[model samples]
Target: MGALKTSKRSDLKNCLTKCKLFRTDVTGSRLYNQRA
Candidate 1:
């Protein structure tokens, strides 16, 4: 049970990080497009 909770927490963290990265990438692309 404890192991499953730990795994879930890790997965959540990974998902959050991925979402943040994607947002940053999208923002960067938008900025570059505006500049162009």
Candidate 2:
């Protein structure tokens, strides 16, 4: 049970990181487009 909980927490953290990275990429592309 403890292991499962830890795994879930790690998965949630990974998902959050992925979302942040995706947002950054989208904003970066927008900035690049504006510059071009």
**What TM-score does each of the candidates earn?**
0.98, 0.97
The local distance difference test score of each candidate is 1.00, 1.00
Model 2 regions more than 4 Å off: none
Q: lDDT tens string, model 2, 1-36?
A: 999999999999999999999999999999999999
For model 2 the local lDDT of residue 24 reads 100
lDDT of 2 at 2: 100
Off by over 4 Å in 1: none
lDDT of 1 by residue, 8-36 (tens): 99999999999999999999999999999
Model 1: lDDT to the true structure: 1.00
Cα deviation of 2, candidate 1, in Å? 0.2
TM-score (C-alpha, index-matched) for candidate 1:
0.98
Per-residue lDDT, model 1, residue 23, is 100
